[model samples]
Target chain A: MFELLGIPPQALFGQVLLGLINGSFYAVLSLGLAVIFGLLNIINFAHGALYMMGAFVSWMLLTYLGIPFWFALVISPLVVGALGMVIERTMLRPLHELDHLYSLLLTFGLTLVITGVFQNFYGVSGKPYPIPAALTGVMNLGFMFLPIYRGFIIVMAVIVCFATWFLIEKTRLGSYLRAATENPEMVSAFGINVPLLVTLTYGFGVALSAFAGVLAAPVYSVNPVMGNDLIIVVFAVIVIGGMGSIMGAIIGGFSLGLVEGLTKVFYPEASTTIIFIIMALVLLFKPSGIFGREV
Target chain B: MTHTIEKSQADTPGPETQAMLEVQGLNGWYGESHVLHDVNLTVNKGEVVTLLGRNGAGKTTTLKAIMGLLKSRSGSIRFNGTELIDLPARDIARLGIGYVPDDRGIFGSLSVLENLLLPPKVADGGFDLPAIYELFPNLEERLDSYGNKLSGGEQQMLSIARILRTGALFVLMDEPTEGLAPVIIHQIGHTVRRLKKAGFTILLVEQNFHFARELADRHYIVQEGKVVDQFRNDEIADNLEKIQGYLGI
Candidate 1:
């Protein structure tokens, strides 16, 4: 109904909501990347593939097995995480003592294999997952109309982000994660099984990506190459935020998403490139990242 | 699991009857280089023994080998009747060994309380928080502080305190007083004496003979990668010149 600087309130609100939605994906995906990088120092190039797997797995469950979105949400991640754990133990764990480049290559190859298989079976055209029956309507909040599912996404991202904070900062298991990340040998000497922790941490990190993937399934087209494009943006978020702190990743993701959204409103052509430009600026000035001091 | 460690302890001899630790013909390598050649030594229950050596003389490596910290190590490291050479550092720790390293490997990210809580309880009879704080009052005062925030002396104390909480009767300390004020060294010495009185076996590596002289019942002098000589605390009085001349200090 109102206009500011010749931009209608509807356009601004609509894009702002879109920005928040994209930010939620960034937050969830980058949280997993930051955690994996912090402890394992592995780049996990297959992160995007795993995310695609999460969405596709959920899609498979809904289509083939007649499972609902809620059940698929929990089941998809567990199945994907279990697969991730096996990959860690069999493939990544042996290369733990080697250089980071080895794991990077290993994961990159893994990404290609996953992408190729999915593309072979499904092709490039995408499948659209239907929004659940309960979350189909929109709520009119005076000047702005909010889609309930979209609002649900924003709330879910906030919840997931804060839950990670609790898991990493507050609990005793978190203490071990923090300690082991610093000097795993010392922690091992202190009588803790660090190898097992690494395996679990890898599984958990990928599980977050899968969870984000399931959240994304209903929003985005469930295609093989869907994660291929989004992962680059998610990684940019991690680079800008610095895989150092959980909160840093969350804020970085949300803020960058909003920036991209705003760019879409002001200049449609620059929306995609804006995040990369900021990422370059961040890397040039603060190479350690905004949350650089922490691990 | 804790069961692996507990089961080994149960098979050992009763307390005070035999040697708490018996390391024989131990050898260790760091990558391509051999560091420890023949580090044979023993520490009976409740006894205090010191590994005396100059820098780079393999004293620290001996301790590392015993604890299974080295990836390539050989020969026997028996702790309370369990052959420990095959076990990993963590398993050896679970078999009732506490290690305080030279660098005081404190996790900077964790708070003081978390550092203390990091090591799982290995056995019964470990000092409770009140008892540990009584021994090192500074730790209690700085419980909320980060591990990296502590002073050199406090970090050293924290390192020692955390291990003591593990109820590990066989204690291995590598230069606990390496860089500390005189007062702090005296306090550590007093703690060692008290630990001996409480029936904990100590295998300490020291270049500070004065500190070693006061606390050790026996001293094993390391040269290069072998135990070249040994002296009982009583017998060291007569061999002071030879010991000092050998030490070159």
Candidate 2:
């Protein structure tokens, strides 16, 4: 048993592992926010609520419908993404020409509605989602002990983040999405159905959030208000990373998570406030964000 | 100044050649600002026309209105005998009409090759990569450069080249030579002549009198959002002073 700075190695490793887990969530969630903001220019306030829906939907599938976790993983995101598309076409489409505030307000109201419905049915108490049988063990790596489920989460988050980056930076569809984000009229002039593109982008953006939610289901409590709290942290990560930068979102998430984890080790009281403090300092110096190009 | 435009009467379509594009009583606005008013014009098949005007004379607005880019536009815009007044910009583009704006809307973040390949092929005759490269060798040289990184002339060329790849029968080019060195301007003029020879109908908007005179078969003098005057290529020689006077150049 090794000790560094008066903290035992196991305790330090435990906190670091927890930080990685939280970082994974931030990376995936912030990636969604970035994608949505890039294309729609709307800060999706309902993202947290939608993420909660993903977890709850997966929970319900297993509890009432006898659906396994594997099947629920695929089913939950699809359901949430379909709902996201409906939201875009019906609520967000008409607000496109107006100020961005309207969309934000609308999504905020939607967040309340969705969270309220879930709370009404399920209440506030967190429900446990049993970890799958295959990932129900711990790995001891000399200096640290890692839960297989947490390692799975970290790996999944990294894969999802990189896959999203590759999709946007290396593909033709991504080129159109990026081009449309810059100038929708010009992209439309190129004969692309930009309205349809916008609709799909919104759906895809929220789908990423939902996918993150599915991933979080096993780790965090499947509670209605779970996303409401996590989303704020993700927003901080976005501000620090730069809005709409794929690479920035991914890196910002993990780095902030680790910083928070390290803070927990040094001063337990400041663990939560450190992200906001860093966000403020980053805003003061690099307002465009770490990866953001000039707006 | 160096040459009077070769009047390509042989290339100009006859009066019986049905109009390729016709705009009747077209009106457009930017919010409350009325930009184009009662603009009526026609582009006959295989003819290169110019919309000659000073800045903010509604030349660009007319082109935008025809392309359905302006949301508050009304009246008639008929392309290839099909009514196009209410079509979305995307639908209008899909109908085989291409636009090259004065600002040259190249995606700054995208590479030159991406910008060139961005526009989808609209018809069978659209320029392929080899043809586009052959037409503008400069584009081939800067294939990997970002759109914003290109020189002004290169951006303009890329802008024009992008539309040419769309196989659009009618191209509405707005001030293609707004700011360019003489050599690049000369090259654009040469390209315009070659396109006209290749049977592409063009409705060009230009503030440059010398450049427009060299490429346009007919000229429409726009004054404050209205079509104030029109003259044939032969009439251009006699009306050079009038054209200059109208443009206030």
Candidate 3:
């Protein structure tokens, strides 16, 4: 009954809702990257693989133990986050004194090993994780039929991002983290246990990615390489947002997803390349990013 | 060479004369370049001891070694009879040692209040907020401002004010009076005197002989990464020329 700009409202609104869903994942994942990079000073290249593991952990929990989506949701992140702490302590601790590149390569190598192991076990084909019973139906929002589970993803992502921002910005522990981010030696010299704070920060950051993984499992397929492709886009989202800025990551992620979605509606051929184009433009003009300050 | 290994007979702490810190044969290196060869010194309880030397003569390095900040160092740093060489900087701090670095490490992103509250409490009996405010009224006035935005004297006061709240009995001050206006230097000297009266052991590193001579009870002349000589405050009048010769002032 209604058409705007030669495009039907259903198609436009449909893609916009889909864009919001993808935006939720991007916001959560990029937020994790920013937090980790800020405190640990290392690019977590294994993040995508960890996201995949979160999905796998949930899948395994449901398939083998007859656990449901709700329980798997809570368990998967905890399990993955515990593993993250182990990675930080055993693998990354020794390289603390080395250059940032070493940790990046190490995490990248971890990505390969994790991907290889998952591929060996699960094969390239993806598995389908069913939507929970309560969220199976779609809500008719006059403009579009919105999937309830998709809306839940968006709401949950906002809650998580807000909580993380509050923790880093408003609390005393957050003040310690910010100070440590600036100069860890002085923080530790002040008698705060900086290494312990580091491990906990890394664990929490990884858990954010794992949370996104579980959220993506129901919408996307539970595949070993599921996060592999999405993570590249998330990195571009971070670059456009600014490398270590929390607000930048959240705003950059959601807006870019919308841009990508609208591009699909207006020009289908350029949807995938639009984010990279913006990234290149941002790097050329403001290398520190929109929210990042001068070094 | 003549000092004890953290427990020299000359520095033996007793009830009447308590030795707070004893650093013996402290050798430090920045990667391959050795900065400190043999640094032997002692600071008794409530005594303000100054490590007087020219720039780069290992005075700062000695303080850093004592604080366990250096990457590589070999020495005995004892605080209250505890061997501190093997401990981490945080642990050393927990042992009641407060550090006010030469550059005055103040976090730019944090507010002045946050910087003052940055250090966790290491012991009991430290200056409370009201007391710190009384000492440095400028900090209380600039509580809402960002740390790096403060003036140099304010930054120095913030730097020292931070650890004073931690209840640390011993303070390692590296050039607190350096690069300050004359009025600020005089203010710092006044603060140091008050702190001494209140019974805080101080290990000061200074190129300013006049500042050292006024505040310190004893002075150790450090040259070429070693402690060349030491004397009491009364001995300063007898060895003023010798002290000026060593400091090259």
Q: Against the true structure, what is model 2's DockQ?
A: 0.71
lDDT value for candidate 2?
A: 0.89
**For each candidate, what is chain B's TM-score?**
0.93, 0.93, 0.93
- Worst window of 10 by summed lDDT in candidate 3 chain B: B1-10
Off by over 4 Å in 3: A1-3, B1-16
Tell me what TM-score chain A of model 1 achieves: 0.97
Error of 1 at A58 (Å): 0.5
- What's the ranking of the predictions by lDDT, best on top? 1, 3, 2
| Candidate 3 lDDT | 0.89
Clashing pairs for model 1 are none
- Candidate 1 differs from the real structure by a C-alpha RMSD in angstroms, to one decimal, of 3.7
lDDT of 1 by residue, B72-105 (tens): 9999988879999999999999988999999999
Instruction: Report how far residue B86 has shifted in candidate 1, in Å.
Output: 1.1
Task: List chain A TM-scores, every candidate, in order.
Answer: 0.97, 0.98, 0.98
Q: How far does residue A72 in candidate 3 sit from its true spot (Å)?
A: 2.3
